[model samples]
Target: MQQMQVYARVITQLIASEDHTVQDLNSAISAVLRLNNINKSESPQHLKRVAHYSRLIATNCADTYSLSEEWIEHLYLFAPLHDIGKVFLPEKLLTKPGPLSPQEFERMKTHTLKGRDIIDHMIDSFGYKDHLHYTGMLRNIVTHHHETIDGKGYPYGLKGDEIPLEARIVAVADILDAMLTKRVYKEAWSMDKTLKELQKLSGSKLEPEFIGILASHKQELMNIRTASAE
Candidate 1:
């Protein structure tokens, strides 16, 4: 309990201090999540790729999305935290070799809500409840990234434009990386296959407008994916 208090104090000071750069804050957050056993079956580069992809998509659609540079940077930084809640999940379920049973799948779906609860605690502890673009954006990303455009997602059935834009963007970034990166359960998908699958998800599972924008930067995205593997 005393150690947790000290760690929390460090994180609060780190993020609350304007003297620290976004990169510094991002590193602090990453370190905390890693310490907690955040799981990513892909290489450590998974977060980097997702952040890069999310930034590219957000920048490309800046006009449509009304994104400012500062906001875009924050989005990139927070994008990687979307799955931070997975750390709370049982290691056995997370590393299970085969498909999960329906019960296990339901339990898995709780990660979104779990992520939100985690962020809520952090905001309360850090006293950032009033910071909309800061804590609020992160909360939205944690809770809504898995929601679908067609209202079929878990935790909440948010449909169409109802899902927060930041979450929607991270959703695309997260899915792309998950598909393209090799995991123990499956081989890495070819870029062509990944793109094809993403295209199919447009308007149903993802925002269709952003899908085209993301595809236009195929080469850059691929570069981010490969660079991480190195």
Candidate 2:
């Protein structure tokens, strides 16, 4: 524990003052996860695109939420960490070619809690001690990205403004990225189909304001998708 504390302090000292340093930190953690095969089933580009998409959405919608520039920067940096807890999940479940059974779905939901717990452990162990101003934003993104505006989402049934604005932005980014990315269970969805699905989910499963924002930005979204694929 003492050695770990020393390691944590060094990391904190090095990156504590700059938000951009968190990008390096995030990438290093992602590399570690990849080396250990924790992210083998996931695309390396998926996280990057989510970060990009979250920034795009949040940047465009900042005025609506009165979001600060710092907050949006944090959203871009930490959006990729939303699924970090999937490291604890069995790879078999992540790569399953069919829909998860009821029991499996329950296990899947636990990732939200697990993600929050993992961050809590890091903060405590690394002696970060709240000096990390954006830790709260990171935690919200990790723990609540799956939550819905209609009180049906898990980890917490938070609705409307009850959900952190950061989480809502990341949630939109995540859903859109997942739709366009191919997986064992589903083919990549076309831009038109994905937008229609987002329309279907608007206000019910996703934040209505964000859906409205994306509705007008179809061409820009296609550009993002094209860039990510290249």
Candidate 3:
């Protein structure tokens, strides 16, 4: 109990401090989720994998598009929170095995806004301004990660570059992880199959440039996934 209190205090301090690093935020987020019993997998490493793969995808995109290393790092840290809104979802809805009814799907869609709200609340409560850009990027990731290149995505149908670059990178990362993982409703897709699906969706469901970056760093991303699973 004492240790948990210390952890909570440290997390609160980091969130409130202006000098907090992305690494600090990442650790704090993980600790908070664990304390809340939010992640209950055998390995419970999905968030770490998502963070690693998101950063790799972002790095590849950053290099291909001539973005800064700082921006890429910000995407790495913020991508994990894209699903933070799931915390607002009922546990039954989140862990359901069957296909969602139309009503349930509608409820599920609220996660995007819920996630954005959580982060926004955190920013307001913590009063940290030094990482404003990071916070903005995280907000984009949470709110727009569902958006597609062809304007068919949810929350908003932002097309092409209208969506934030960080969100585009996260889209690739999130889909890749979801495709590769075995969920309650579906078996894991093979890497080859997943890559082919991504290719098929390149222009319509995903940004072509980001997909190109993902293709270029396929092995590196796979390596990160493999390492995280081990």
Candidate 3 Cα RMSD after full superposition onto the native fold (Å): 4.3
2 versus 3: better TM-score goes to = 2
lDDT of 2 by residue, 134-173 (tens): 8888779889999999988988899988998889988998
Q: In model 2, where do residues sit more than 4 Å from their true spots?
A: 1-26, 35-38
- By lDDT rank, best first, the candidates go 1, 2, 3
Report the Cα lDDT for residue 89, model 3.
65
Which scores better on TM-score, 1 or 3? 1
Relative to the unseen true structure, what is the C-alpha lDDT of residue 227 in candidate 3, on a scale of 0 to 100? 76
Candidates' C-alpha lDDT:
0.78, 0.78, 0.72
lDDT score, residue 119, model 3?
64
User: Model 1: per-residue lDDT, tens digit, 174-214?
Assistant: 99988887666677799889999999999899999888987
Error at 181, model 1, angstroms: 0.8
Task: Output the worst ten-in-a-row residue range by lDDT, candidate 2.
Answer: 2-11
Better candidate by lDDT, 1 or 3: 1
